[model samples]
Every structure is written in structure tokens, then in C-alpha cells.
Target: MNPTRRQVLGGTAAVVGGSLAGCLGDPGAAGGDSEGEGVFTSFFTLADFTRHVVGDVAEVQNPIPPGEMGHQYEVGSQAQVDAARSAAFVYLDIPGFQNWALDSAENLRSNHEGVTVTDALANVELREIGSGHEHGDDNHEEDHTEEHEEDTHDGGDFDPHYWTDPVRSATSVRTIGEALAEADPDNAETYRSNTDAYVEELETLDETFESELSERSIDTVVVAGHDSYQYLAARYGFEVHSPVGVSPNAEPGSAEISETIDIVDDNGIDVVLYDTFSSPRLAETIVNESNAEEAVAISSAEGTKQQWLDDGWGYVEQMKELNLPAFKAALKAE
Candidate 1:
């Protein structure tokens, strides 16, 4: 009943200019050393992947603080300063997704000679965020007004949810390994080895998803918040329907909510999945109005929750424990 299939995920920058430019200067000047100046990632997910690749060879730091959305969190210039002191900054360099990161990466490449900037999104064929009523009336299209400033970062255009797809993430694991090996050539072997092991796990996860979702009673999964599962849907052959589009800030209108409820009723779906990061009111309403019996929580893993950290639930755990069961229930997969 499924119709589909699923690639590699590069870009690393080398900075060779002035002496680390003030705070990000040399060891003595910048108050940093090889051990202290480790790899700094843009957010939790990247940090998790980078940590796996580095394997204690180099410390991995996520500049985004806890309880903050990685896409829209405002850390001002502190993240740049901290990252500049590191051997590398790992972040997706796609424009509009993380404009500040793009700017900061450029700064590191241009001014910080000791730092390496790697764009995890390099060579990735990003999907555009599309609009329409998935199972609703064909004549109704959601408004694309003066919002969606973060298509990926929190806005629209190319969907920046590739990390959600384990197949693509396996490729990203290698990309990070390559970047780290290049940054610290002495441990290139270790980085490569770690990357290989981690990638194997990711590929296995991809297989789990494929095998689990291949034969499903339903073809679509409806979310009550902003859609973050395009990569997952595309990779696994299911479509994601949501009232919200790219921007997390945008609120769903009454019409959108009514249609999403209609979708749940039309599909005979019993479970409604909601982004853990977004408010659950919309999902609760959808469940109340439709035949859906329960609302489920599925995190994107872009940020972390205290409980998630307490349980040591990284990206893989989040996907398996949270998303996997939710999809299995909603899609009625065998």
C-alpha cells in the first residue's frame, strides 16, 4: 500500500585569518586549550550526533540552553563567542533556517582561523514546505501571509526537518565524522570508527521505521501543531497533515482546526499526534471534536526536556519511544 523510497548528507569550512579575533583568540588569549576548545554544535540534536562521533575524543557542547526551542531561541552573541573558542561549530547552514547560525558560521570562517564550520545541510536535497488541505476540501488552501519567517529556523520554503529521517541522519553522521576527522586529524581513526558504529545504529533505526510503517491501515497521520514530520513521512511513505505549517509561532485559525478534525474523522484515526514543543490545546480540541480518542506527544528533538535528559533519551530514543509508538497506533500499522 506504500509507494516510495529514500540520501547522503557535507560542508565544512576552514578559517585562516586573524588571531581568533579577541574572545575567540589563541589558547592564552582566548582562555582556551585543545581539550577545552572542543566541538560546539548549534543545538541539542547536532550536539548529540557530534558527541557520538567524537566519542570523548573531543567534548561536544550545545550552545542552546535547556527548555528553549532550538529554532527560535535567542542567545544573542554568546553562542558565537563560545563556538569560536572551539575547534568546530556544527550547525545546518541553510539560509532562513538559522540565519544567525549562517552569520555566525561566516564570522568563524572569516575571522577565526582555529575554528572549523560545518553545515550539516550541505548536499542535502531539502523538501519545500507545501500547503493545502491534505484530506479537506480541494478548494481550500491555507493563507501564506506575512508569517513563516523561519521555514526551517521557525519559518518556511525548504523543510529543514531532515534530521527526523533516520536514513538521512545516517548520512549526516558520516558528514560529521568527516568534519571532525578533518578538524582533529590525530583522532581521524577514532572519529571514523565512532561514526561507523553510530551510523549502523541509525541505519537500523531506518530499517525499523521502514519495516514497521510499510503496511499500514492508513496513509496519512494528522498532527495538531506545526508539521515537523515531512522528512519522516517522505522517507516512510506516509503524509503528515497539520493545521500549522512551517512557523511555530503561527496559530491555527478556526477553519484549519475544523478541517483537521474532519481529516481525523474521515480517516477513522484514533490517535492525534502533537508536537511536544507546541501547545496541546489544538490537539485536545481535535480529539474532542473528532473520532480520535487520544492525543499523543511526539518531540522533534531539536531541543531537550529535563525528563528526556534525565532518562538519557537522545534523538534515537525520542524517535523510538515517542514517535514510533504514536505512529504505530495512529496508522494502525502491523
Candidate 2:
């Protein structure tokens, strides 16, 4: 179950953080007075976004290990304690996605007097698991939607994968930028300017997706794993069919698998999409069972540290390189 927004807000007292020293010109410098203060993010995606906005003005810290899935990550007591002591702690307020951070919000505030805690999703609009336009067989969609609705964490009703949509992710960039500016007033202009530049890039990315997907004939996609691409689908006017629901932790039963296979066969889905963090077995099964010719990896932006480092793929790059191509081939776009 997911936590309610009320529960999450109950933890907030007031928002307010500090100077570390490090070279302001070098973005890669370690945390210190010369560099700036430490800004802790709950996941790599947020950290990546923050880095883009803050540059070398503040040192961004993403405690979640590279390659580890952020949704399933459980912060240790020591780590939690240490994070609370940072200059600013940025976390997704989506309850089910980052339950530990939501639970620790109040504690993080109480224990650390000067630390600022910002909910990156505070101003972003979130989607519910099955709230958007429906696709696929009516019966199967209903069953899966019901299952997702029941899978709550403090009673919240939103999908936390907004980063999958570059346009939607711009909202987060703004939220994070404002938080950073507030935390370090000295670099406020830089943060705002950087955010504007990044948002422009995101807007361009959104236009590309709109133009490309609009020209595609196929309107449905089958993901063998969880249905994390709902935001992308909704934004671009496509329907996503997945065996599992929104949360990756929720396992699909045999009946669900069979239904997904049916969707693949009926739609002539050429490629089954799977996230980098998911097991390929389910995608392989669907491909083998149906006429689907292949399977491809679509990053959910929850990639491991080593993968991101090795690939050097940023959020926009992942969508442009991996997701866009996969969607084009799967949909048989011109």
C-alpha cells in the first residue's frame, strides 16, 4: 500500500541549509568549502538532474549504489542518519516508490537542524496506475488496474515514474532548481539559468517524441515487465500493455502472463520492451510464445551506477537513444 500525501506532508515542519568549500568552477570536485555544500538526492535520476541544474555550485550525493533499483532500496540506519545531516536532502515524495524516505522525512528534519528537505515531486503532477486512457482487452485491463489500486503504501494514488517522460520531468527540474536556489542563495541565479537551459532541452526532446510517435501507425506497446511507461504512453497517445502493474515488486500471475502473450500476438507487437533493471525471462517467454520477433531494453532511468558511468547516457540520451528507437521499431514507424 502507498502512503497518502497527507501522511507525507505531516512530516514537514518548515523548509530551510550551508557552505562547504571547493572550487566553484570544477563540477567534479569533491565536497568541501571550495566546491559548495552537499546536496543529497534519493536516487541517481534525481542526482543526475540536480547535477545538471547545480553544476559545480553544489556537490550532489546519491547514496543509492549504482545499478541498484531505487524503488526497492532500503536505506540503512547509518545512511539515513548521515543523509539527515547533509545541507539539503532531495527525495521523491511519491510514497510507494520511496517509502523509506517518506517515512524518514520527519526524522530527517527533527534530527538535523540546518538540513533542508525538499520533495522533488511536490509540485509535479503524478499519474495514478490505471488512471489514463485504456488500451488492450477490457477484462485484462480492469483486472490489472484493480490489482494496482490495491497495492497502496500509506494510501497514496500516483505512479512515481514521471521521469520516463522528458516533458513531465521538466517539472521536477524546476522543483529541484527552486529548492537548490533556496538552499544556496548565492547560486540562485545559476540554478535558475541552468534549469531554464535544461528545460529547453527537455522541451525539444518532447517535441521529437511527439513528432516521431505521431507519425507511427502502431498505437499499442507491450512491455513484458511492469507498466512503468504509462506517462510516456499517455503523453504520446499510445496504449501500454504489460503483464505486471506499475510497481515492479508486484508479480504477475500465470493468467496475467497468458493475457499479455495474447496481447502481443493480437497486436503483432514486434518487440517486447523490458527495463534495464528487470529480468529478461518474462520478455523472452512472451517473445517465444507470441509472434514477437525480438526484445529490447528501455531504461527506466533507474540504471546501476556502473551502467550509467560506462554508457555515459544522461536522462535525455537514454530516451533518445534507447527508448525512441525501441518505440519506433516496435511500432513499425516510418
Candidate 3:
């Protein structure tokens, strides 16, 4: 006999414990988990997108606690072991962003006979990290130590924050939908239809971003946090200047900070943008030193659990509410 929904979720809670308990809860208790089939994802944004595509077809599980910055997140051994056994396990294939997932993906596939593993970024074109912001001044070439370069993950060759770009995000949705459909063939049609509708919504969001950003007077956005918006910047034809590279944990040197300040001052930027995951101290420093009048928080779609519950926020909703407005203010868009 198959285990009940409560039994499965309770078992998951017992295995993972601590943060996982709070993150998983009862699978069917809320957020469209009525179907009782398990669809586990590595992070919150992917969880939200999977939930949107699967709807009532499967119970989506996002084991990462809300407000937890994904790049810095380390999954417990027991939790990884348990999660590898899930019916469907979805994760980004990007290294360093979710090192645990990348490290264990192959092992999970080998061990979990029933689990379907999906890489949402399988087809998306990832932006190379060092390609952002080339200063033409004397501060252009700062020699990063070999250790720092390794710490920044693969010499910052690829940006993993593809979800920030709606077009890429839609591709992820399609990838996830196909994976889910293949995993549960019985509900394949439903999954595909839902994905189609969700993709349409994302395409509409892409249109909105293009229309709004094209009217902007300013083309440069200075972020006080890590550089996670390369794909978004590339998509919309805006320059993103940041003190650090992709990982929030990668600390910027004083020279990089000075360069960022110079960029903001030279561009007459009025707003400095900070990501939700990183500290605002750097943003404050940049704003104080530059012509930027204020700092705004932009959601990287990596939200806290309480914020999501309180606001009933989803990926698209967050992009529209937090990210879009922040960009508008930062870029001086009409």
C-alpha cells in the first residue's frame, strides 16, 4: 500500500529536521499541494515555478528555508540523502550556486530509481561572469588573486541567476514542465497546458520589461551587492555595475568599491540597487560616495518563507512588484 500524504511529509520532516521541517510542513497543507504527489526542488524560485506548472498535479516541495540565500546554502547530508529519494527532484545545473545539488545530482540519479531529476537551466544561455562592466580608466585591470578567483567559482565564467531574466525564466518553466510531465505521464497533458499558460505569462512579463526599459533615460544600474543580474542586463540592454561578482559571499576589494562609486558618479545614477540576500551596508556606502540619492531592494526571486506566506508572493508577482519598480526607479524609466 502507498503511504499517505501526511506520512510522506512527516517522514521527510523527521529525516531532515531543523530548517527542513519548517520549510516542508505538511505537503498538502497549503500552496496547492492537494494532489499528494511529490515534486521536490532545490530552491524557492524553482519551487514556485514548478508549483505553478504542476498546480494540483503534484505536491511541490522546496526544502530550503525562506529568506535563505541559495548560493550560500549548504544542504545537510541527511537532507540530501532523503531529498535524493523524492519522486521528482529539480535543481539548477549551475556549479557554485547550489554546490550541493551539483555535487550530488549524478549520485541522486544513480540511487533514486523512481526520482526524476531535472536541470531547469539545461537549455538557457548563461552569461559569462567577467563580461560585465569593463572600466576604461586606470582601475580597469585589478589583479585578482588565484585563490579569490577560484573562490568566485570557475573564474566567474557563467552567471547562474538566469531566473532574473523573464525570457530565460520562461525557458526554465518549459524545461521543468517537460520534466514533470515525463515523470508523471498520467498528468502529462495538464502539465504541458499549465506550462503553456505560465510561459505565456512570462512572455507577457518579458514584453513589459522591454517596453518599460526601452523608455528609460538611464542605461546603467549600479548594484551595491553581488553581480547577479547579467542576464537581465543583457536582455534589456542596460549596463550593470557591481562591486563583487556573482556570488554574494565573494567580498569586493576597496579598489572595486571605488570603481563602482566612480561608475555611479560618472553616470549620474540616482539610485543604488541592492539584492535582498546581501547586506545593505555596501549600498549605503556607494550611495554616500556617489550621486545616488537612495538605495532600493531588488528581489532576485530568492525570498524568505514568511514574506512569501504573508504576501502570497510568486516569481512573476515578485518580478512585477519588487524587481520592476526597483529597476524603474534605478534606471529612471517612465
Number of the top-ranking candidate, with lDDT as the measure: 1
State TM-scores per candidate: 0.83, 0.83, 0.81
What value of lDDT does candidate 3 attain over all alpha carbons?
0.69
lDDT of all the models against the reference? Answer: 0.71, 0.69, 0.69
Clashing pairs in 1: 97-153, 149-155, 150-154, 150-155, 151-155, 151-156
Question: Per-residue lDDT of 1-334 in model 1, one digit per residue for the tens?
Answer: 0001001112332222222112211234444333225677888998999889878765788877766667766667888888777767778744455666766766776677556666665444466568421221111112122233434444334566778899778777777777667555556788889999999999989899888888899998898886778888888988889898766777888999999989999989999999898788999999999999999998887888888889998999988888898898889995
The best-first sequence of candidates by lDDT reads: 1, 2, 3
Residue-by-residue lDDT tens digits, candidate 3, 288-332:
988889989887786555766688888888899888989998899
CA error at residue 225 for candidate 1, angstroms: 0.7
Candidate 1 has what TM-score? Answer: 0.83
Indicate the residue-level lDDT of 299 in model 2.
76
